[model samples]
Target: MLIVTGYVQVEPTELAQFCNEFSALATATRRRSGNLSYSAAVDDPQDGRLLVVEQWEDQASLSAHLEAADTVAFVDRWRGRMLGNIEKYDASNKRGLMD
Candidate 1:
């Protein structure tokens, strides 16, 4: 299994639009067979930070998701709107046990 954590910072004024689109893509991501989950949350009230907790069956499965239309679109469109940085992390099956 693979666990991917993604962090995105948005402009305070642009957070609402960012969340609207991200939430839709996350919903579709969770519907995929290889997807264990695709959940996201903001850091705090009025904060522009967003964190995504994603789980997939394996590396190949996650790669497939990377090619998915929704995923691709989200990457292309939202990337420019993002603030400072976007962070990513991967955890293998054994490491994921702690989750």
Candidate 2:
């Protein structure tokens, strides 16, 4: 499994638009094959901080997502308007913490 996490800070004035665009992207991403989950949460509306979390079956799936045209376009569109850090983790040794 692969886990991706990140946070992006946008201009407060642009928050609503950002969320709207992200909602569309997330909706599409969720329907892709090998996608375990994808979401963005507003950590601080005042600061326009959005926390992003994504899970995929593996690196290939994640790579495909990154290379997808919509994903590319979204990133390009927001590149200049957002500041963030994104990181990926490999978790092949699965564990059930709840169990």
Candidate 3:
């Protein structure tokens, strides 16, 4: 499985715009064949910070999802205004295979 944990910040006034697109993207992604789980949360009202948690069946699934049309639209539409300081993470070494 693949896990992605990350967060981003945007202008408070743009929250609705971000949520609209993000929610749509999340909905579409969750319905995909290889998507196991997906979620995006707003942690602070004043900060306008958004956090996303996602799980995929594997790296291939994640890559495929990234290439999906909806995802492409989301990125092309809001690549600049929707995110600030986004971070991505995974558990590649969790099973100790790298050790």
Candidate 4:
């Protein structure tokens, strides 16, 4: 499995609109094939920092998601609105105590 974690920051004034847009995107992403899970959390509402965590079946699934038109459009639209660069980590699943 593939896990992805990231944060995107926006202007405080654009927080509400960004959340609204992300809500729709998250819903669509979760419904896609090969998607294990997808979610967004508000790290600091006042700072407009948003955190994203996602799981996928594999690299292929992640790649498909990245190429999705809606995903591309969302990124393009929000790129300029971002307060800074989006930080991301791509990781592979490893044995855990629960597993």
Candidate 5:
């Protein structure tokens, strides 16, 4: 499993628009092959920051998703307007905390 997490900063007034647009992207992404999960949430309303989380079956899936036209457009739409870095983690040696 691969996990991706990050935060993006948006203008306070533009938060609604950002969320609406991201909702469309998230809906489509969830239906894509190898996409385990994808979501975003308002992490800091006062700061106008949003947290993004995603789980993928593998690197290929992630690559394909990133290369998709819609995905490209989404990023481009938020370019310079949002600030953040998305980091990926490999969880091949997964474990249960409750185990």
Candidate 6:
């Protein structure tokens, strides 16, 4: 499985607009093939900080999602509206406590 996590910071005044755009993108993303889950949360509303979490079936699925037109468009639309970097992690569902 593939896991992605990150946080973005936007201007407090633009939180609502940013969230609207993010919601549209997230909804579309969740419908894509191979998508396991996609979500975003407000970490600090006063600071306009938001956290994102995503899970994919594999690297290929994640890559396809990244290359999707909607994904590209969303990035372009929100490029200057937020600040943060996303990181990805490779994981396996081993039958263990740590898993």
Candidate number of the best TM-score: 5
The lDDT per prediction is 0.78, 0.94, 0.80, 0.85, 0.93, 0.90
Q: lDDT tens string, model 3, 32-91? A: 887888998998758789888888878888989888888888788777776655444565
What range of 10 consecutive residues in model 6 has the weakest lDDT sum? 90-99
Model 3 earns a TM-score of 0.81
In candidate 1, what are the lDDT values of residues 1-99, reduced to their tens digit? Answer: 777776678887888888899889988888887898888789853668877788788778888889998889888897777754434456543635467
Which digits, one per residue and each the tens of the lDDT, describe model 2 over residues 1-99? 899999999999999999999999999999999999999999999999999999999888898999999999999999999999989998878879985
Residue 25 displacement (Å), model 1: 0.3
TM-score of each: 0.79, 0.93, 0.81, 0.84, 0.94, 0.89
Best by lDDT: 2
Q: Please give the distance, in angstroms, between residue 47's alpha carbon in candidate 4 and its true position after superposition.
A: 0.6
Q: Which of the two candidates, 1 or 2, achieves a greater lDDT against the reference?
A: 2
RMSD of each candidate? 2.9, 1.1, 4.1, 2.3, 1.0, 1.8
Model 5 Cα lDDT, one tens digit per residue, 4-60? 999888999899999999999999999999999999999888889999899999999
lDDT of 4 by residue, 1-99 (tens): 777877889998999999999899999999999998998889999999988888888788888999999999998999878854444455664678789
lDDT of 1: 0.78
Q: Kindly list the per-residue Cα lDDT of model 6 for residues 1-99, writing each as its tens digit.
A: 889999989999999998999899999999988899999999999999999999998888999999999989988887887798789998875367875
lDDT value for candidate 6? Answer: 0.90
Off by over 4 Å in 3: 84-99
* Candidate 6: residue pairs that collide: none
Rank the models by lDDT, top first. Answer: 2, 5, 6, 4, 3, 1
Clashes of each: 0, 0, 0, 0, 0, 0
lDDT of 3 at 85: 58
